[model samples]
Target: MPLHPKIAEILAILPAPPDGPLDPVAMRAGEESQVPPLEQRLPLHAVEDTVAGEVPVRIYTPVEAEAYGLLIYLHGGAFFLGSLDTHDHIARNLAKETGLRVVSVGYRRAPEAAFPAGLEDCYAVVHWAADNGEWLGWNGETLAVVGDSSGGTFVAALTAMAQDAGFDRITHQVLFYPSLDLDFDVDRYASLRENAKGYGLETGILKAFNAFYLDSGADPADPLVSPIKRADLTGLPPALIVTAEYDPMRDEGELYGKRLAEAGVDATVSRYEGAGHGFVQHFSWLPEYHRVYEETAAFLDRRAE
Candidate 1:
């Protein structure tokens, strides 16, 4: 399918990335400046900032929603960027749309804290939420995890870790155009080439994120670093993986869903036509933002196929 007409306009109007190596720090500032002011953000029931297992997290509660379960959100920004504040509107709207209490993790970013550091923080917050469900007014027991881009990488690895660590608390997993595989150099997926550049997230920039994400000696192919490297996907939580038609990350996300279903996990993959990476974040031009919310609510509620 061709790019959405609006998407083409978005791409045309957007500035092209620098031709050289992208600096994580510079990119962070550029992206952070784009966040809408608080008054312009969605009106939620109540939003609070608190610590969950020593990790800072922002909690958003929906108005009169006491039945829906709690959700943990990990925002996208490759790995070096993104924060609770950067994605405040998203978390707020997610809670409102899904009618669930949302805990947005402010995990440590890369080129500073590195890989496991961020992942550990996300897991710690989940543990804290499970232990303090009553205090957060959680429905209890039903805990779902959602992430986009690099954060989605954490969600995938965290599920496997939770299983191995005997933390079988996550009931559902949702990934938004996730970068499941860190091995970006491989030609394992066609979208890497088909939608590599000029569709929003350029190929060079993505490779740069991959380069900065890992500071350790661990290979990019490690299962913990790249969840797609994990051979056995059995026993993982049910998943709703959303991928965009023109996004470079599309193939791995869809493939992950296929692998999950093959491993007997209940997994559904939805490709939003004429869309690309991070389409749900933009509300001014695309309706996919609301579609994401509706789809997620239905999936989390087990009311959709």
Candidate 2:
């Protein structure tokens, strides 16, 4: 299928990335400043900023919901750039569509906090939600975790950790075009070459992102850093893995889903034919973005029931 007309238009208007590496502070500030004031008018019952397990978080509660499941959402920013503010609209939309309380976490970013710290913050927030979600209107046992890009990397690592710790609080995980394998052989994935450019995220920039997120002497082989390297994928929560046809990370995300299914985990893969990475965040301009939310909500609703 051809690219969605609106998506093509968006691509045409997108400014080229900086000539060199982006300053993390400037990138974060620029992204946050452009976030439309869409959260205030979202159909959610309430939106609040609070601390969960010492991690900053934004909670979105739907007006028409009751005793809903809770979702701990981590935003996509290559582990170095995103904040709750950067993904506020995405979180609110999820809350409104799924009737699930969405907790968007602002985990510690990398380069400053580095590897384990950000992952630990996200994991802590989930543990906190499991124990204290009732105060936020969650009366159901159903709990889910979701993320995009690097955030999805966190979801994968958190699931593995929770499973190892015998924590059964999370029932489902949704990963959107996730970078599951830090050591992924780029030459093996054709998309890395075919869609490396003109798709918003280039392969070189992604490599830089990984470098910024990893410690100076960190081993990318660690399962927590690269879940695809894990020897075991069994006993993890059901997963809904999404990918974009033109995304550099598409193959790895799809492969992860296949690995989960092979390990007897319930995993579904949805590839958007005309979409690119981060379409969910660019929902306003991409026609396929709504499908991402609809498919996600349906998956969550089924698991919750």
Candidate 3:
């Protein structure tokens, strides 16, 4: 299938790749350029809440009615970059489309915080949301965890941890083009290494991010570091896994979805033929991105009912 016309146009307009080594500052600026201006959008309620100590969150509520469920959203950045502002559109779209309240976490990023630190922050937000459901107008019976890329990695780990600790409150888990495996030997990585126009994820860059996120102290194969390595995929909430045809992480995301299904967990996996890893967040520029949200909202709606 050919790439969507809108996506193709955006790709054409994107500036040529930077000349120097990829540093955090350059990566941050590149990411910011891809995002819409924050002030031009409708404001989400920003709150300072304690999840072990004061953490900030931007909460989006559907205009239709009080939400029947809450989505604790973690933004994607390969564990190193990105912030609440980068994912603001996604959070708002999910809330408005699904009629669910969304609480987007601003977890600590890497180099400053590594490995389990960001994961733990996401977990803390989930715990906090579950504990404060009523006050937040969430039904408690229907709560979910969702993310993309590294954020999806956090969602997978958080789901595993929540299940192991007997926190069964999660109704569904939604992963969009997730980075489920830290190991780089996958065939998809080799096959898509040169795909420059789709989602900007390259094999070399992914390897670098993995090294930074794991640091020197942790093994890359550790299940927490790579959710696909986890032994028990049973007993987690039902999941909806979305992948893109050209994403380097596509195979791993599909494998994780299959693993969940094989473990007897209810899971549905879908791969968009010409889509890329960050499509869900880029819906404003690429019309096809809207389909991802519709699929997610439909899945959540069924789970809620």
lDDT of 2 by residue, 1-305 (tens): 77666777878898877777768899888988887776455566788898886899998887755677898999988788888887888898888878788999999887888568888999999999888866877775669999988899999999999999998989999998898888745796778888877777777677777778765334678889888889999889999999988798888889999999999999999998888888888753355578688888899877533
lDDT tens string, model 1, 1-305? Answer: 78888878868987666787778788888778998888988888788898886789998888865555889999888777888888887788789878889999999887788567888898888888888888888776569999988878889989999999999889999998898887776487899888887788766567666776765433577888889999999989999999988888899999999999999999999988888788877642356446788898888887222
Q: Give each model's whole-structure lDDT.
A: 0.83, 0.84, 0.78
Q: Score residue 86 of candidate 3 by CA lDDT.
A: 83
lDDT of 2 at 242: 93
lDDT of 3 by residue, 99-216 (tens): 7888899998776775678888899888888888777888766688999888898899899999999988889999988888787764545434545335556665667766667773
The count of backbone overlaps in candidate 1 is 0
How many Å off is the CA of 290 in candidate 1? 2.1
Q: For model 2, where is the 10-residue window of minimal lDDT?
A: 282-291
On a 0 to 100 scale, what is the lDDT of residue 276 in model 3? 67
Off by over 4 Å in 3: 33-35, 42-53, 64-67, 186-199, 216-218
Evaluate residue 106 in candidate 1 and report its C-alpha lDDT on the 0 to 100 scale: 94
RMSD (Cα, Å) of model 3 = 2.8
